[model samples]
Target: MSAMKEYALGVCYAHPKEMYDLYDLLCGWEIAERAVEMEIVERFGGDTYPSKDMFEIMQGIADILENIPDEEALVMLKMVSLITDKPDLMEEELSFWRGRCAA
Candidate 1:
């Protein structure tokens, strides 16, 4: 499946509150996918599938979450948690990204 569709599914699965609006989810997905593509290109010299650098991928995700509002950040945390299969890390990841924004 496409990255955007995979991201949307993860977000919907981990949604913390009320259902996310379709438009907002789609917009966020586009933003996230773009970030992923950029990171992939930067790290691998090509925008290829199955990124090899976990650190860069996480950095890309953190960057995306930091730019958006807190509410949207929660949704993104959920998506990241789902993708990473580490729900326990959500708050810590959020805090890390928030700290990066502060720095």
Candidate 2:
């Protein structure tokens, strides 16, 4: 089963406030993700930026994403989808970085 679905089922009996806490955490991550995107675009927009530095930045972001538990990551992605009003943004952008780090 999907981690998110699993999480939902597992937490079915938890306090309502726990869900709110998860929402708050995901919101913080969404803001951090946007900040990272903006920083990358502003600081590394052109050929003038060194590839090595760009790789380091990407890796750092990827590491942050990777450190989250898989279930929490799935939950965060779902929350981001709901919050952004652009459903594919996090999956596309963050997944690309995550893939890069994996490679």
Candidate 3:
């Protein structure tokens, strides 16, 4: 979680001064991930990945979280907890992924 700034969207603007550096920081973050995705296509992207795999699932949800306009993705996350009937564990898992997604 500490290296969240390294990812394209894994950051929270909880302070005022952060806004001043947002543009550059965000661009750098996105570029860094893009580079990795380019070099590690088998692991990071493409259609070969199975939907049931955790990495692929999380990546898909992360993409949804990153692209959507609002907190709408939270609803889908909530549905995951309902389907699993594990709200408590899902709560913590959601926090970690949200920290990872930072959406």
Candidate 4:
């Protein structure tokens, strides 16, 4: 999942002191696959999926996260987990929380 960061929302926030950075919710984590579905519909013209396709799905989720609000980041994260085929990313998101607590 290391390549996950390539399209991560964290890349948009380079300042260490910015209060609204979404890294706490996105670091080493992946978004819900449903979010990808919604995104694909917006990106493309339809919602029907082929038998098996993940490329467009991932790109769509990344793009949706790019425009979401921080207050809603957590909810979005949870939604992504519930709707996707992937495991829940709560642990990874909380890892950031734990690091912040220690810092």
Q: What lDDT would each prediction earn against the true structure?
A: 0.43, 0.42, 0.34, 0.42
Q: Can you write out model 3's per-residue Cα lDDT over 1-103, one digit (the tens) per residue?
A: 4353233232232321222222122222323233223223433346534333445434544543455333333333332323233334434544554454444
Off by over 4 Å in 1: 1-52, 83-103
Q: Write the per-residue lDDT of candidate 4 for residues 2-74, one digit (tens) a residue.
A: 5544434443332222212233333343433554455445444565443333444455345546655544444
Query: Which prediction has the highest lDDT against the true structure?
Result: 1
User: Considering TM-score, which of the candidate structures 2 and 4 is the better prediction for this target?
Assistant: 4
Q: Which residue runs of candidate 3 sit more than 4 Å off their true CA positions?
A: 1-52, 85-103
Backbone clash pairs for candidate 2 read none
lDDT value, candidate 1, whole model: 0.43
lDDT of 1 by residue, 1-103 (tens): 9987686656544433322222122232324444434543544466444444544444645454454555455544445434233323434544544444344
Report how far residue 53 has shifted in candidate 2, in Å. 15
True-structure lDDT of candidate 3: 0.34
- From the highest lDDT down, the ranking of the candidates is 1, 2, 4, 3
